[model samples]
Target: MERGNRESLSSSPAAAASASSQAQPQPQPQPQGLFLYHERQRLQLCLLHALNNLFQDKDAFTRADLDTIARQLQLHHPPQQKDHKWWILPLPSLVFKPHHNALTGNYDVNVLIAALEGSTHQKKVIWHDRRTPAASIDLAACHLMGIMLNTSVPRLRGFWTSRHWTALRNIRGVWYNLDSDLPAPQPFRHETHLVSFLDNTVAQGGEIFLIFNQD
Candidate 1:
């Protein structure tokens, strides 16, 4: 009886150990591409939230507003890449210049619109003569001018090309060749929508900007 009791106790421990090991949750392995994709999605959400906060209670924004937004963005998501710089170029006015110490090279089109709309200084009228190929502008400049200027502006009728994609915002109130291959009269409900659209585009290897054109 004593030997039997000892054996049972020893077997009980082994059985309990086996059960405990089986009960413990195992970590599932994630593919490298999928993991990176999820991380990017999380980061994109953070950026969109920050932008939404920046636009609250404001109809139009200025360069100063962009500065504030940039600071918020940096605070929320610090630069992951070493010595990363963000460039801003306001077409036919200010050239590409580094504005922030972040890793992202893509521009934020919404911020560019806010900067241009809020500016008090009048931009000198420069018409883009169809006779001459409209000068190729950067992603930031193209979206900025497109959103801020009236469709009637002759200079605004040029085709703008970005690194990843080419799009035409409006040609005399007729939209054509828009980003995401979206159809004409794109459904732009609000600023948040615009930011979201840009975010999705950027994620899909599309070009963007975030700099405030001070000129």
Candidate 2:
């Protein structure tokens, strides 16, 4: 993972990310069946995978592209500097910012918002606040593009935990769970089913970010 120019925070992070992600997106094929479910390896890159799945294109982004964004964000809004023991060398994890983990890729929601909003596709991220009722979100809305969900999963036989990114998007008139954990994209029966599914997910400590295109 190469770090971009670690010079100054005065420069815009979004501008840097735009240089790559804002390239005119090549036309992508629509996912039709099982064949489309076969996506590339997305190891520890659920944020990248969720973006590609939300946009329905494997080539939508790269780990490097997101990495640059992460770096820039860290540069602009760095965490509090701490004095380390003179004898101890600083670890990369210590320098890693909250927006993303430089080692293990557990990119947070801020990265998601930045990546999508910075891209040329003009997508907007609207976080459905936990205080609000899930049903209050009109599933029938015509402008809805998709939904990105962040779930916490236990790992190493429940010894540790990590965050996972997933998406709910409409394909061929059906809603599908484009979760990286799933072997195949699972389709929701209808809009109603999708709403209930989201409600349940919220109850279980999941966060939802609704996506839409700027008019």
Candidate 3:
């Protein structure tokens, strides 16, 4: 073959190899799991809306405070439980009324213990009165709903009441109130460190579920 022809043949191997490689199918990268852009955008928008609601009621929730709470809720990165439900983290310690706040003098530790044992919420409550024997109090229940001290965030006691009622009615369900407080109960002031409700669905590892506030 002529020198030019020989050179062409030599280069053809490289071109052929390239074309063959290109022709072979490459596995398309699996799209990163369920976190689609639209979903993320929707969540962001919802979060913003929630923040905006908080802002409009800034007196009830200061910017710094809201940001802090948002960060806490955002830190959770658990997988989604279902396509619809929101995720929430239960703070068992903070959910119940503190010992000092129960001034009704009906310090039935067993009542609190029973409530804890009976709690069916995602975050179960277990009262340990023996752990701190010095505290004189009864009626122990997880601080399912509490007010952030010095804040005007209203307590949806009625909402909790309804949830309790429903939870009590449904034995198969895993969500419920600790116990049914007796009527004509002792008067006790509300004092707690819980912030506003973030949408926290229990299915995913850690996601904020939807929060419903009446009023």
- What candidate 2 gets wrong by more than 4 Å, as runs, is 1-41, 86-88
- Residue 170: error of model 2 in Å? 1.1
Candidate scoring better on TM-score of 1 and 2: 2
What lDDT does the true structure give each of the candidates? 0.29, 0.69, 0.21
In candidate 2, residue 126 scores what lDDT? 93
Give every collision pair in model 1.
107-208, 107-209, 107-210, 108-209, 108-210
lDDT of 3 by residue, 71-94 (tens): 333345323443432454444323
TM-score per prediction, in order, is: 0.21, 0.77, 0.16
Q: Look at candidate 1 and tell me the lDDT of residue 107.
A: 30
lDDT of 2 by residue, 1-215 (tens): 22111112121122212122333222233343222331322446788877777777766777887888888888888878778778876676565557877765778887888888885677888999987877888665677898999988766569988888988887657777777655446677777888888888888899999998787
What is the Å distance of residue 173 in model 3 from its true position? 46
* Model 3, position 90: C-alpha lDDT score: 44
How many clashes does the backbone of model 2 have? 0
Error of 2 at 166 (Å): 0.7
Candidate 1 Cα deviation (angstroms), residue 126: 30
